[model samples]
Target: MATPQIHIVKVQKIYRTANREVHALQDIDLEIYAGEFVTFLGPSGCGKSTLLNAIGGFSLPTSGTLTVDGKAVTKPGPDRGMVFQEYALFPWMTVAQNIEFGMEIQDKPKDFIKTKAEELLTKLQLKDFRDRFPKELSGGMRQRVAIARVLALDPPIMLMDEPFGALDALTRRTLQDELIRIWSEFKKTICFVTHGIEESIYLSDRVVVMTYRPGTVKAIVPIDLPRPRHTTSPEFNELKNILGTMVMEEQSRHQKAELAGTTAD
Candidate 1:
């Protein structure tokens, strides 16, 4: 078999506050092959975001290691593109300018940046909004700009943290389809983090379920359902139910642990 594009080996994360330290992640061993779409799904406070951050090099693990494309990740760079829950766009820049900002920072030639920005705008179906400010656009449009900005860099990997979490149901669904289309067309290795079980199942080749905080991998379920998945289909519901049960079980286990700690204290 070919080597996985992203390899995370026995990773752990610990956060230190004023008086104590908390373990946020434990022994997270994951491998994402090139062109695969994977998602981390769990309830609030799970380490889904942490794991995503670690992979993007926005944060470092306290122990173990993380590698992407055969190199260890120590800090953030243009090689991995990130899309956050918030749009994360510069308010002052127009859509086209924002998309070209990365290339500007890298001092890429003006013509190259312009061409790349236009290409990404076209690819993301945002060509008409190139002159608009982020504030002038709707939430979904702004997110499309955000995604285009990242794609303009031509990164090999994408780390998205609830990229659609803030949109309305209609907009979220629309963006989900757009995302899948983009993923299929580009074949970028993607690790998307979301709390929605159905959303995870719809977008991922495999779903990695995490335990509630002080999180660890509880289960990694392969979603073998046929593509162009339907939300109302019987097979889809069955897979959702199975994953839902596992998530609920993990949540219950975490709640019981919390209650026990309270009692002991």
Candidate 2:
């Protein structure tokens, strides 16, 4: 068997202010295989994003460890790429430049950077808009550029935090298909965070459900359905209902906490 591409063992994260401490994550244990796509599914304030942050090295856990390719992840590095819900493109730069930014920072040859940017622009269906700025593009177009920027870097793992959550339903579905196509071609190990149940089932090889505050893995459901999944189909609906039930249970806990003046996750 291939080695685990991303490993999380007993990971825990705590945030302490001057007074109170928030337990955001607990005992996260997962081994993501190379090229696999996994989604962290939970309601708002759950530790799904926290777990993604840990893997991206954006934040550290108070205990346990997260490793990629046998080495500990201590900081954000080239091996992992991140795509956020917000389009984090540089407003001053054109689409081409934004896509090439990471490569330029790495000091890769100028020709290689330019060539890669062109390839990604074409692949992401943004070749015509290469000269456009973020402000000039629509939400979906901007998001495509955001994803293209990360893709141009060619990281072995992609960490996405609700990258399509803000888009319209049609755009969201379109981008979901686009992302799956990209995943099939590039085969990057993906860890995506989302609260959408159908999105998780449609996109992931496994859905790791997270519980309320002081979140832990509540369940890990394997999505054994075939790709290009039809939401209207019986098999698809069945998977959705099963996963939705698990997710709603945790959401119910979150709602009860709100009534109790407790953690609202």
Candidate 3:
């Protein structure tokens, strides 16, 4: 329906080296609708991040196609903004300057950039830290600035690669709530990659479970729970159990593969 905002068909990514070839992703066909929040969930080496990177145009697939709004995704564009596990802020710049960096590069007008930066500072709860540098702020505040920098461009799709994974649990939860608020207000399609089962359940409209290396879509589980989901709720735990089982199966496969590779070596 509505010509899915991001349409991926048979996407596969392979990394070739002098000694070996690694198939990072395989047969990844997914259709993400506009304004929907989706998470790619699986174990390490499952290619979830690889898939996200392909969608973000940080890397290209070896075969198949990924398109946004019916056009091929050959490179990164302003339509998509990416946040990483590492707070990728300019260490030398103040919070406000970091937020304004992208717009400045785009040659946005001085007044517009200033106004937008101020709005983001207030909206992301970073008003007091506006003049602080990255090192001066806490992990959570740094991420907020990173997010603000992305939002300054006002991308329609947000690609977040475990943006909260490095923070403390309490901080992670706080950022999750903030992200949900932002998504609700902006109505942006979000493609997030994470290893946290509960985090995926809490954030996504659908959880895409992936297989181990040479990743394939094992199952796409729709999260039907209402918003502001509670982790302890019976419904939440039930879905968590299902997803946890699927992820465990893949992780076992990954471990077996690793052992076999070691033995062969």
Local accuracy of candidate 3 as per-residue lDDT tens digits, 1-265: 4799899999989888777888889989999999999999998888999999998998989999899999999998778999988988989999999999999999999999999999999999999999989999889999999899999999999999999998999999999999999999999999999999999999999999999987999999999999999999999999999999999999899889888882111
**Which window of ten consecutive residues has the lowest lDDT sum in model 3?**
256-265
Q: Pick the candidate with the highest lDDT.
A: 3
**Candidate 2 global TM-score:** 0.97
Error of 2 at 110 (Å): 1.4
TM-score (all chains, Cα) for each model: 0.94, 0.97, 0.97
Q: Tens-digit lDDT track for model 1 on 1-265?
A: 8998999999999988767777789999988999999999997667899999999998999999899989999999888999989999998999999999999998999999988898999988889989989999999999999898888887899999999999999999999999999988887888999989999999899999998867899889998877788988998899899999988987786678677772111
Residue 257 of model 1, lDDT score: 67
Model 2, residue 51: C-alpha shift (Å): 0.3
- State the TM-score for model 3: 0.97
TM-score, structure 1 vs. true: 0.94
lDDT of each: 0.89, 0.91, 0.93
- Model 2 clash pairs are none
Candidate 1 vs candidate 2: the TM-score winner is: 2
Tens digits of lDDT, candidate 2, 1-265: 8779898999999988766788899898999999999999998878999999999999988999889999998998867899989988899999999999899898999889988998899999999999988999988999999999998889999999999999999999999999999999998989999999999999999999998888899989998888888888898899889888888888888888888876633
